[model samples]
Target: MLVNKNRSSAGFALPTVIVASVVAMMLLLVAASASTAIREGLYAQHYRRLAREAAESGVVLASKCLELNNDLAQWSNSAKLRPNTDCKGAVVAGRTQYIQQDGNVRTTFEVGEPERREGSIQRITAVGRTELIRTTDGAVWKSYEYRLAGQAGLSTLLDSVSFGYATGGGFAMSGAFFTVIDEFGRPRSAGFNGFGQLGVGSTTDTLTLKQFNIPANKRAVRTYTNFLSHGRNMFALTENGEVWGAGLNNHGQIGNPGQSVAWVTNPVQFALPSTDNVATFVAPLGIVTFVVTSQGNVYAAGLNEKGVAGINSTAATIKTPTRVPFPEKIRADAHSWALDSQTAYAIGESGAVYGWGNNEFGQLAQGDINERRAPVRLGDFGKPGKTKAVQLAFDGDTVYIRDSAGAVYSAGKTNYGQAGVPTFRLRAGVSNRCLAAVGASLRTENCSSTAANQKWHLDRTNNALQVESNPGASQNRCVEATGHNGEETRMRWCAWWSGGKRFDFRYPTNSWSYVYLSNSTDIGGRGLCIIEANSATGDTKMDSCEYYTHKVYAPYNPTLEQVASSGVVDITTDQYFATMVYANGEVKTFGLNNGALGNGVYVDTSNFDTYKRQAYNPTPVKFILPPGVKAVSSWTTSNGVDSKNGNTFVVTSDGRVFGAGSNVTGQLGIGHIGGGTNGIYPTPQQMLVLGAQGNLASYVRSGYGTTVVYANNRKVFTVGNNSNGQLGDDTTTTNPTPRANKNTNPQRHVKFY
Candidate 1:
């Protein structure tokens, strides 16, 4: 039994010991897991903070690079972002966009993730295009620099043209729909095929006819070719919605650039913030251009047959494109027309097309003939594409336009192609069919046969050619000279009214001229007026007398006004004069001498007058004095003497003082004297009081007639003119030099009653 019990106890001990060992092992594992978790959490938090800091550093680096290379042309098209570019180890890595691949350029964006474990580590990787074009074109520069923050917008009509004239040269265009001038004197136009002006590839001058390679959409324009420009350059547009121009000035129009000659010649892409250039407006057709020019600015240039040239007359010329006044950044939706270099017809962004400029042909649309150099509203054409443009073309001699959606019209010189109808002459000698056809062909050839001297007339009675007039033809059929007393020949355009019965060429009877026309008719209209060449009538006399007068008076105005009583001679003049009165009782003047209460100086004098003129007028009384007078002051006496010598005092300019005249009782401040000779001193005497503290041993009151003297400490002295105790020493004694006052309870010093 004892042996079995001991065995049982040993088995129990073994099991118990094993169980305790297992529990202790389990507790150790749990503690290790918890500690590991806490350490890992801390490591992760630190890594995240560093990662964020690295990212912020990258952003700052990018911004700095942008600023550093802001003025560089390459920056305009360069799309490289280098975060690792930071040398301070702030940014672990950086990502860039738009890198070069092979021979091509493209755009790409990248990102960098920070790996912070062994200090600060980061990985930079980019997944985007790797090519880009680098050139600083006007459009690109404008977009890049003008971009506020990160975006930029363009507004208003665009034009293209060029010009040459006297005075400072310049080009014109529109920005934000406002007419503006560029650096070049030439008007802005797409005549120069370079610099992507017409959005075309080649840069050449095609005067006769040529096609433009502008893409159907506007956004693609800039993408096709990029250019770089630096300094004094310019660009402009026409009134025909066509942008043209040339200028790269660093001053005035184009702002301050660093270099010179940044001329641009082509219709660059421009669009406002909310609109897409590719979506709204119609793309320019082949070889067609729209042009706009103006003295008041606001010009467009491009193709538009619907009277978009803004040329209201036929005699005017659009030398170049320019800006027009419109709401800033607002797209102009209305139509316009130019009558001449001076006048224009504009349909406001909301109003009708008004005519202005040289209104010699009644082009002002006011039913009268008068030269105007501004815009005037024509009949309303608010309905969509429909416009009240009577005729919108230039006939070397006149302007032609049909009513809105009506027949063709004409205005100005009707000698050649002025009248778009046939003309007739005497066919008596030739009855052959061939001759008749030739004659008819010539008349209908848009020419007046200047060599033949024959009238271009249509058959009003038979709707066919007439050999001769029937004795009494309406004089209205005849082209007559009008305006300026027959100085201007009126162009008559034939109209087939009354079912082709009466054929009368209609021409503007008044004067105005045309500067630009749309891209529809030749001479009259056909393509946009890229650059409207000036007419032979270009007169530097474009200025009027009233204009000169207005300018002259613009800066003239009065700067001062004088307030004067009934008869006061209060002179009003610039305050640049100085006046001097002399002891000789004369006034001397220097400078402008506006006006003062002094004697007048002689106006005229000999050349030998060297600072020498009449000293003064009313001679002053002289008070002789010894060479060394200390102080001076005037005094009065109780004798009631109103003598001039009694009221005088002098302090020499050399620090000496002297006194003279009246001495009622030492009032002259000299020693006391007898009443008669004492009070009538003509000679000035010196007062010596150097020993008195705060030594005011003596003083005189010339204006009010009184004298006083005060000692250093608290002593007081008085004399002179004591009619009412004028001398404040408690006593009414009118003494002179240094009198002592011991009357008042030693309280008050002195008083001038």
Candidate 2:
């Protein structure tokens, strides 16, 4: 066909326009592809950065593990045990993970077991991973290495913990990592910031376990929490024995002269005296802090609190630390609890046990309840006499005294029978007349030991009164109400009247434990006080006993008396009873029994006669130990608040351990709990039975109701409560039986390492 030239030109222009459009579309496609690749690279870098941070956290924790003598399983935040996590030759020591909402984005780290080498260097491996999507193509993984080595000549490692019941959550000791981990195994150090007790550098609460900045040369050794601290005040003692305080300072308790805000978020080294190094510290809560210098001088600061500080001033609170006028220099010391009340005991360099301060319950055993302004000799200790006190423990309103002859005596609040077997006569706070049995009838008579019928002992099993024909007589009678409010108390054989003679004691003050007769119909809120019937030698009658200075043994310090008395801030203050392993290989418990005493009196303690039976008298714990086994040290378990009732474990000279007392939490390490009235072994049971050789590990630690020991070739062996994975056995199961560590090699292991 023939084509015209004019028609060919029009078709040629349309083809050129199509080619131009195609070139623009290709450029746009190329630009879009380049932008997508850039975004992918950014995402990969972001994940990698997160992985790096996780790896860093793991290495820090691993370094701590090395510092703690290579014991990796004693942490509450230990990663849940997983087999073969990111290492072929190395075993996993710790693992943790962080995740963003619904686990869409996550970062994780796993620490390998530390390997010790020459030059004191430790090799640590950490595996870090991140994921935006659940696929290898969208994930990042990396391994980071860390070398943890001690100073060339360093030879000491301190792994310790200090705990006390306080209004706030609590403070952590220096050697232990007090990290509260989240459900994802991520550690959190944040808590209530009202008083800055966490020492995280700000009053603002943060979840990350922030570092407590201190001098590189200084390390924390002990933690102290004020028993009456409303704002959660706390302080730490350094390895050099200098005080470093944090949190609330409202009474200048932290030695910060002008804390305008009344607290600190960061720890500040205390303004200690420049002259001497510290020998020890006594912090029984409240506002006072006592420091005993190595030269044996006593210094104190903060609230006098019954003159316990011994500064001879009655000021509201001592703003500066001052030396006390105590007579003699002391080697060891202990004190009582409470803010408005206190008592302190010290063992003089001459072996005399001296006491001062509040004596509301005759806890100082000076034959009276008068508060001492300064130190006074209570008795001699470690002397060569049966009556002399050899060892002493002061807590609450009681003092536990152990004699050289092996007899134990408790002097303190006998209210509710906590002071053990001693019986007393109830003297009317108003009339001064004592409750006495006048020829089978109850009457208010003059208080006297000669009034044999007046001696009344509490039936701890049922809170009933037991009056005897004479003191220590076999015949017993109980006091009860004959009729209504205006009638006399009826005297009947304890079993003659089935009405169940029950009486309750209530606290009216720091020293008065008031009584309430349970059967009285005209019951006042507290109890029917036997007020004067005629203002003369009053005929015993029931009347209202409330808020009056009308009784003996009043209790006002709201915490457990036993816990207050037995506490020490430097070491484990959670112990309830005073346990001693005699030189003769016998283990004895003295102080408030509360079923933890293991003295063949299976204390069910579940209430009843007014209160549970308790004993402060020293009692023996029977154990069927091997012939060569002789007692050595003792470890007792208690939180002092929630776990006030406790268990006892005794280490023998032959590397074996004997356990006794309450087993409700299986804290006795007996494999199986005793099926008794209170799930306790009234007698001691051999739990940690090892070789007959003296290979027993010396380090043993107990928390709440758990016990940990390094016995099987030094590999960590955990027994007792594991409800929170605190045993570090990689399991949450609370099996009473002891658990072996994951990479448990041949070694003996016990914590408090």
Candidate 3:
């Protein structure tokens, strides 16, 4: 603590001088650290760029390698990596291969192998590493590692170009026939010309597109047609807001005064009065046409038998376009109508989806199959009018939705796993409680949405009840009976393929709806039904199917798939495809995958591609998310059952999206379509659509062999099957990849009421 003020300057220094020297030393050390940090920062940038280059190189090599191997088919080891030319390496630690380059800019690349390698496309990653060096002597210091993901293999993407812009806002297709208005306002068409449906002044089919006989110089803005085999009417909206039609005139489908003629034979302007000239969209399908005017009014023509036209008319057909009683503007398109099934979905201006026509399978999500004479708004899974839908598509009895959140929901005909969730909940008629899982045992408990224990999904695949998910007892477990009378029912392991507890869910008339175990007997063979115990005990037991003391309350449809005491058993032919893409990138897929679920599980043909329907909850699709990156959004789609195949798509944290599954029609939009594993992409192939002012699509909507993409809500693109000109490229040939359809599509005036 003592300081000397005077000391020999050469031998000893003053306290202040010594302290100042120490401080200077400390400052020098800090400066050295800062310099080191700045150097590392620069090096980090260089390494990242190097890593990205490495990834690019890997992709380039793989592209050549896959080509050499004929897309893995020609590879001697098709299931694993086989070095080809400059692509040298092996399947090291699950990854396909490792590529090393010699230099100070050290680089290594690895191809990421999925659980299965069925597709021609594959994913690869690269690493760039560097060593720290001492600035004084240039001696090696420490090593640092960096991983940077860069995309490549876009040669095909660059080849795809836009079909060219046309003022014609939209197009429509049906039964190998397409109705489109070219940029020159000519109504061109090709494909099936039955009943003069081609409107080319003749009834001969033409692979080459031909123009309609509309002589008027009206710039067409919208075109409408149908996929229905029954009525192939085509309608077009003019820039002047006038409507015109050519094709089937039966049922007044062409706005004719009467159904005296079977076909229009030419493009004739409709005499229907429309002071509502702000018509922006025209939807013609089945046997009806709906014109959406900017004034928030919908006008309808043609068949009115099911009130699909929404005119509420007793007259089976309307000769002229009549004002429909729709409360808002009709938000419709080519896929909006499926009138052949007496079912049609109409999007209201309020962003609400309305359904009419056949409700036979509750495809309307109305909770009942009662025929809807007029359009009825559909309810969300839990409540009514909560979700705002953007678009909708149908595959048989099942319906697919493109809602506001970029997610898909399903409904109707769930017996084959079409319904994404438990169609209904069962309550005990003997008590106020509901049937629930009490520690893997069946019991009566207070019903609440806070837990999934009370929610039961009927497994039509095996005729058992299963608990869907967590926050409750027996999660992912199924109900089973010992085939003994008065035995307590318990929740146990479920076999997705088979061996699920075979309990027959029965709905008996003039009696209670019960779960019957036919194997149960009392010293003699006699069926037993699951019944409720005392309200205080919250226990469930098996009793005679004729037990009069208990009842089962199904809040929704009771005509579910089950073994009736003596009636019909319903198993929907529709494929149940439900997937949830949570904000955190977690996905839950329920029901069936058309061909393969991409979870290393495919169709078990012996079981007819069927898993124990509803016996299992939503299963997770496999992929390891990289650290610091998670899934932000995803798109999964399927058309048929597990036998037909489907697709799964996901967007990653790196702003990239990938597709896996059937590319039979090039639905994956990766530029090619084929057979077997070549078309069935069991692993994900990155989607980087380019060309025609291309950019990565922000949203994707895949249809039967066709995919439509919207980029930042400004541009529209399509790929896959161009059969019938569905790709809107003015060509009927298959489009191997995505191309721009960026026409003058009007900004949707979606009213979010």
Candidate 4:
């Protein structure tokens, strides 16, 4: 029984052993499967992360390419897709593959067409995909879609011109010219090119626009010209803040120690102080030249008569630059400076006017004709009730001061209607008839025995005018000019209740006898004017003021509403606030602080009684920027103020460029630099680049004294100020140096690095 029991037990043991072995094998197989699954999952995650990283790298590369060249068309070209090279060609269109680490990592990216939206905003869609990797059951790829938006850079294709102006006898007759940019950023000139001010390398004047030689990588960012004399000197501030002077250096205005009485044909660089950057350069219509460093220190050179150089009386000729001694550290906000032949003016951030040099005509506004050797306080600005003086304009012996109220005042030489007071009346030269409001139409009729209808009153309280029937009595109706359907002029009722019943009176010429009456509602005087009807009645009506020969009589009043009509007048038409025109065609006329017009800022005037004002706009109208424009800056006049009549250069969001306004000095960058053809463009003009294959303008700046533009490849082109090689053309021909055989076309191009 024991043996049989043992056998049975052994058999049972064997079966149990076999069952245990099978269970062990099943557990091992399950563990192996689980381990393999975990491994596969980890691999998939790693490959996915790598693919995402690769897509991100592709996006970064594309962003860099766009930064270097913002042109979408160029970015879409396959030739430009090389990762090793600078985006010289256009951007890649379709997907382009990039492989790394022996095919372990790969990415493909594609850029979609750019969409230009309003407000100079541009959007681009880019898709990037990583190489496919094996998964548990199939293959998978990672991708990232990105929407990139930015303000477009400047464009490469556009009509553009660079213009400049030199000081002349008066504001009406400044020496101005222009130069046009070709498809590749080359420049040509037209207009006044005397004394090689145009930097074209020759003094021969051309009646038509012509091309000028320019150096590579040298372009003007700011321009300056002399103000008070015919010895108009030209200066250019390059994109790098290097200054060059040409023409009229008889007084060593070119900053060279021995360069006197010579006309510099090419631009010569100025030996500026060791400062890193120059904030601004002021070469007023005088023999002296001033420079303001970023540190706010002022430097001067040229003739030191009356201590105009701001150095000392001992130096008669400032052969080199010297610092100016101010009573206190100059305020950082003091960015503007104006000079006449005899006086210099500067305004501090505190709104204090500083005067030096000659004060013979009270140009300093110090209430006396005492000359100042150094900067001295001239006006009671920043006071409790006073408006700050924002800008200054000089005409012959007179000084025109523009305040925060948008009103201009004269401190010197009030003759020739500089005081804003009308010296003449609108008496008919033919029938001895006077301008009278007959019903709703203006007509030439017999003057009232008491000069009632003949007498007109300027209501300066609100910048309006009234035609009174009595000397001292108020009339409900004012004189107004109106036209219907763009037809001939007709007289209309300008009731006091009418919201836009204001008129702007201006003297187009030096003569005070004749004036121009434009409706305040009409900016730029487009088809709005007060003119004499051609009929036998000689009736005055509101017609197209486009006739440059039309003239009217000044309104007479018993009490002086304001100063006489003289110098420059900027009226607050349309809106009582300020307006700003940006490069992106965005215009904001309201929400401006005092002196915030023309890229300048004034001290806050919330506590002052003086009204806040902006730079005077003859026509208070909004300006539309060219398509794709993102930025704009106006040309600085000789007075260191941006003139509405001067040029405005614009840079497109995609790096294109255009210009508008006065092209007298080829500052507009258009190809009209010579030929006495002074173009006053009312709208933006496209700027072409010479030799620009596909290069686009990345930046633009205007100093009415000079003009400059820059391209994507870092190449620069300048058209003004070659006297001191400020344009970096490597030649110097000073003005008034006899026949130096220098280029006088203001539109001449100079290449700058």
Query: How does each model score on TM-score?
Result: 0.22, 0.56, 0.52, 0.41
Taking all chains together, the TM-score of candidate 2 against the true structure is 0.56
- The better-scoring model by TM-score among 1 and 4 is 4
Report how far residue 592 has shifted in candidate 3, in Å.
2.6
Better of 1 and 2 by lDDT: 2
The number of the candidate with the highest TM-score is: 2
Per-residue CA lDDT of model 1 for 1-753, tens digit only, reads 455455665556768898999999988998999899999777455434433443333434433332233211122112333343332223344534222223322322333322211101112222222222345431221100010111111111012111111111133331100011121112212222322233233434322222232222211110111010111122332222333222321111221122133333333422211222122221111111122222223433321222333333232222232233432121222113322222334334432344444443333434334444334444444346654442232211233333444323222322211122233222111110011113212111112223222333434343322322222233333222223322222223224322222212211112111111111111212111111011122111111112121111100001101111112111110011211222222222222111111222221112111211121111212345444432222222111112322323443323333444444445545656434342445444554442334444332223223444433333344444443333434334455555543331122111111
- The TM-score between candidate 1 and the true structure equals 0.22
Model 1: how far residue 437 lies from native, Å: 21
Candidate 2 per-residue lDDT over residues 239-327, each given as its tens digit = 57777666666667666565545667677666667887573564534456666667887776666667676677777687777877766
The clash count for each model shown is 168, 30, 8, 124
Tens digits of per-residue lDDT for model 4, 308-393 = 77665666778777787765434432134566565677766656666677754445555444566677775575456887766654
Sliding window of 10 residues with minimal summed lDDT for model 1? 552-561
lDDT for every model?
A: 0.28, 0.51, 0.53, 0.48
- TM-score of the candidate numbered 3? 0.52
